[model samples]
Target: MKLSKEMRGFQDRIGHQFARPELLVRALTHASISSPTRSDNQRLEFLGDRVLGLVMATALLEDDKSASEGQLAPRFNAMVRKEACADVAREIDLGEVLKLGRSEMMSGGRRKLALLGDAMEAVIAAVYKDAGFEAAQAMILRLWASRINAVEDDARDAKTSLQELVQAKRQKPPAYELVSRTGPDHQPVFTIVVRLDDGAEAQATAGSKRQAEQAAATALLSKLEQKQ
Candidate 1:
């Protein structure tokens, strides 16, 4: 089967020319749109997840030969998390080509984080199947090079790290307060403030309370680091 012009453009963006074009089609297909004859990307997502994990693990070990498993594990997670995959998918506009059913399209499936991340993994699996491990590894390394380089900072969980820092200083744990929630219920924006017992505090806003809390914690951590 011939690739559509849009898919060809997507190929250029991803720096991969799929020899088996049907693989790309399957990769782009969502379960919501799948029929008895047509397959979805779920299986491909599973394979892609494993392929991504192995590549990330190898890269982390190579990047930090002396690092312990404890240290490397977080960095690997930082690179392979659903949020990270979604971010990369957005970078390449992967949502633009997602094959969704009418219901999914009406509900804005293309912009959904989970769908985008899963599709990204499916695409990775398609590439791995079309070519081989080497091709998939090269594509992943190219796409994720910057993230890998920045993983040291990204691997640090702001909330957990902040808690550790305050506890080390003999302070009470940080508290996250919901300042306000705006936007529609379907897409609410949360404003959160993290306050320490000693009065150090930071505020942040995000689409989810957890993200807002993490942002607040990260901001407070920055301030604490500055003072140290």
Candidate 2:
């Protein structure tokens, strides 16, 4: 069960040494690169998703003893969401260690948010299987500490909250437009504009369409707040 030099280096970065080196290798393997003897991480990803949920639920309760269920729900979602996992994966450069097919690698799979997120979860499950729940919990908590700390600042997605506010004012739902697109096909930047019928609008550019829309909504929401 000895780890290769490169895998051991990856273990060092993640702060978890695998007892079963094969588990680490399997966890790093992607479905796109599957072989007869090679197993992908989809199963591990499923288990890790549950493990992450349980850990986040426990942490949220412990952090805010007085918060009601309604108050804690969104915080829990934000922490356990794929985006959060992907953020942690990027921190550890998990993508660099992944074993992807030639097509995936050529298409920039290493930089894909979903691929990184799933790999991160798989790694969590690998740690959990190799050691135990407590070890997995410790690793998750350490990697997610900063995000967990900032959970209370804003729980709602800006676009949803802004939609509610506009409806309350008798305005139609905001219109979102694709203003412009820049960057490469593999890693394109999108410019999104969120505009109201009355002409108040804000534009934002981001790596993804959803992110750009959210940023645009957040910017427009802030602009509205300043006027009031």
Candidate 3:
């Protein structure tokens, strides 16, 4: 199949030329727009996830030969997590090429973290299928070079750091509570509260629960750190 002008442009952005343009098309097609004749990217997403994991694992081991599994695990997670994929997708404007159904389009599917993350994985799979593992790995490493270089800082997110700080102080792990959720199903906002066993607490609101929890944890951790 021939590639569309827009998709070809996207190819330039990601720096990959698809031998099988159909793979790219399939990767961009969301389930909401799928039909008996047209497949979605779910299968590609599954395969891409494994490919990404392997590449990240190897990269981490190569970068930190002396690091133990305990140290590498979180860095791996930070690099391959859904949010990280979505961030990369946003960087390349992956959402612009997404093939969404009317309902999905109306609901801002292009900007949804889950959708963008899934599509990004599918795109990786497409590149793999179009060429080979080496091609996919090269693309991934090129796009994620900065993130991999800074994996240490990326691994210790606010929430994890907060948990470790409390643990070191002999306090129970911090707890997160969902205070409220509002807005439409597709665009709901979550308010989360993170509390330390010592009664220190902080609340934050965001589009996703994880984000809200992280914000809450950062706030509480900041307060705790100030006292030290």
Candidate 4:
């Protein structure tokens, strides 16, 4: 499985080349792009999820020796969250390099958050399968180093920050409502609305309900701050 000139350049930028280039292609191929009979990244996503968890856990443990599990769990979750994965995909411009079927391409599948996020995970799994754990860990760390700092500094805890802002204003706490949930069982996407007493509302989406709610709260807080 020979890589195209474009893919070779991509591998060079990411600092890793797949031993089995087909695995890299498969990892980039979403189910919407390829039939199950051919190949897709679902299995790779499953494996990547665990690999990602281990990599992030190890990094967190090494960085925060005094942190408790309770404090660490949210930070870990924030790091591996789909939104974070999609952020990395955008940084790498993965959407431009994705190979999609005609229909999926027409439907804007490349820009879809779920597709981008899953493709990122699949790529992680491919790197692990091609090189090994250390290679994958290095790739993930390179992409996620800044995000880990944000998590450690509490910059990623939008919900908590929003609550603090609301309290400072002497207003009642904002409330979150589930506006909608879409996507499959294994990878559900949620849209949530956060409402403040002043009739302001903001909406956001995340891979899970709680994450969506936090995003919504963050958005609401931003709006409030802008008004002030």
Q: How does each model score on lDDT? A: 0.91, 0.88, 0.91, 0.83
Q: Candidate 3: deviation at residue 102, Å? A: 0.4
Off by over 4 Å in 1: 157-228
Going through the candidates in order, what is the number of backbone clashes in each?
0, 0, 0, 0
Local accuracy of candidate 1 as per-residue lDDT tens digits, 1-228: 999899999999889999899999999999999999999999999999999999999999998774555456668899999999999999999999999999999999999999999999999999999999999999999999999998877886678889999899999999999999999999999999999999999998888887688778878877988998
- How does candidate 4 fare on TM-score? 0.68
Cα lDDT tens digits for candidate 4, 130-209: 99999999999998989887784543467787778778878889888888889999989899998877788999887878
Instruction: Estimate candidate 2's alpha-carbon lDDT, on a 0 to 1 scale.
Output: 0.88
- Tens-digit lDDT string for candidate 2 (161-216): 88999899999999999999999999999999999978999998878897688778
Looking at model 2, residue 163 earns an lDDT score of: 93
Provide TM-scores for the models: 0.72, 0.71, 0.72, 0.68
> Candidate 3: lDDT over CA atoms?
0.91
| Stretches of model 4 off by over 4 angstroms after superposition | 153-228
> What is candidate 3's lDDT per residue for 43-91, written digit by digit as tens?
9999999999999999999997745564577789999999999999999
Evaluation by TM-score, superior candidate among 1 and 4: 1
